[model samples]
Target: MVFKELRIMRGPNMWSRDHHNIIAVKYIPEDIPALSAEQFHAVQEYFLLNFNDQQRSEQNTLSQFKWTIRLAALLQDKNFSHDLASPSPDILYGILQYKTEQGGVAALETAAQIITALVSAKEPVSFLNASLYIKEINLRNDFGPSTKIIVEAAQARNIPVQKGPAGYIILGQGENQQRISAARTAATSAIATNIACDKEDTKAFLESSHLPVPKGVLTEDLSHLQEIAESLGFPLVTKPLSGNHGRNVTCKIKTVEELIAGFS
Candidate 1:
């Protein structure tokens, strides 16, 4: 049997609410061989071999199949693990929900291909570097840690969410909705954002609010920084003004040599 197409869909796509993020396929119904109960047990048995004592992996025939697909993607290819969920499949469509960033597309494609081989009793493709491919896509598509936690929490609560421009999120429905990225909400003023982005200006902005400000002096000279460090004492934090995600940040310098090395 030949499989024609695979599709990745995000959100309330005519199927059901539970199928928020899904990997979908549309094919002639007869294309899929109706797996016998015994055949399914064999698949589950292989699953047990792949992941020792995995739970909630046998909720239904389709769930077992998903686990088989996940087994090849995570356990065999990546040596990684993710908590699996078995949201009830759509009665009409049988679409499967996935916890995903955009990277889910690559993962599902890899896993579906592997499971297709297994179900057809074909020799499984060997030495596929699916893990590397998945990792690369994830790096490009995955949310940063703070954003991920918020998004997952929203999903768990069944709050509607959609990816907005860049990596920002739109949550809830029209009237009750809000957009956010990192700690900034949709209402966070543009000028406030500009001030925060420029840490040098942020210090002054804080001072205006009667906040106790850290003493800071800007200088390009390494010798001037060393002199300042001597007065400030050890256990210092240093960062570039244009700091981007903790890059080039050196914390807790105990010795002058280490500080010099950090600057150098």
Candidate 2:
């Protein structure tokens, strides 16, 4: 099968209104045989394990299995009627809705890949190997350890957690929702952040507050940098006027040449 387009669909659609986060795949068909019962069961179990909890009953599992087969059939031909057992068309479209769990998109993509492989293969699929592969992919794409800890902490309190666009995490719901992006929060003071972002300003603020701060000069003029370094003495640090996380920062300059190199 030749993939034409694959995208994440959000908002109201035919399959569901509330559950809008779905992966839609469009493809130009090739000769694909019907999936065997064992292959179908394997694919069903794979999706359930990765996307949904195992606590779901046999009836729920069967329902999901039917849905999976329907979508799989549609991928080979949209016009192919499951009831009539008609021949598949030359073009097809498939949609798979996924839960907003830890892996989410990665899990959905892995399931799709595994299902396609199983559909075309002549032998039984190794679910263990497929699961391991998906686990590695999920680990690579998942949030950092710190972020995961925070998310889990929120979940422990029965707070609703959602993964927003651009890797933001939304905690709670409706009026109580709190969006956390990286280390910043909605209540984070912009004015204070600006002052703290500028090393010179931060140093000045600290000095004014009778707090210990290193003596440093902030200037775009590199010509007088050597003179300033001489006055401040050896073991100087050079950094951008406004920077974070040690970016564009050079430290431990004990000589004029080292200061110049640090500035450069």
Name the candidate that leads on TM-score.
1
lDDT of 2 by residue, 1-264 (tens): 334565554344554344454555554434344456665566556546544524322332223323433433333222221211114555455555543333344544444555566555543245465445545655655556556777767756666666788878888779888998654678879988888777788888899999998777777777998689778998888888876545577887788888888888
Write down the TM-score of every candidate. 0.59, 0.38
lDDT digits (tens) for residues 1-264 of candidate 1: 232444556656655545567655433433455665655655555556545546544434445344544553462233332323334332212244444554555565666665666566665443235556667777666566667778788878888787789767888887999898975787889998888778799998899999997776666678876787878888777777765445587887888788777776
Candidate 1: deviation at residue 254, Å?
Answer: 5.0
Clashes per model (N, Cα, C within 3 A): 0, 0
Mark the 10 consecutive residues where model 1 has the least summed lDDT. 85-94
Q: Which stretch of 10 consecutive residues in model 2 shows the poorest summed lDDT?
A: 77-86
Cα RMSD for candidates in order: 6.5, 12.1
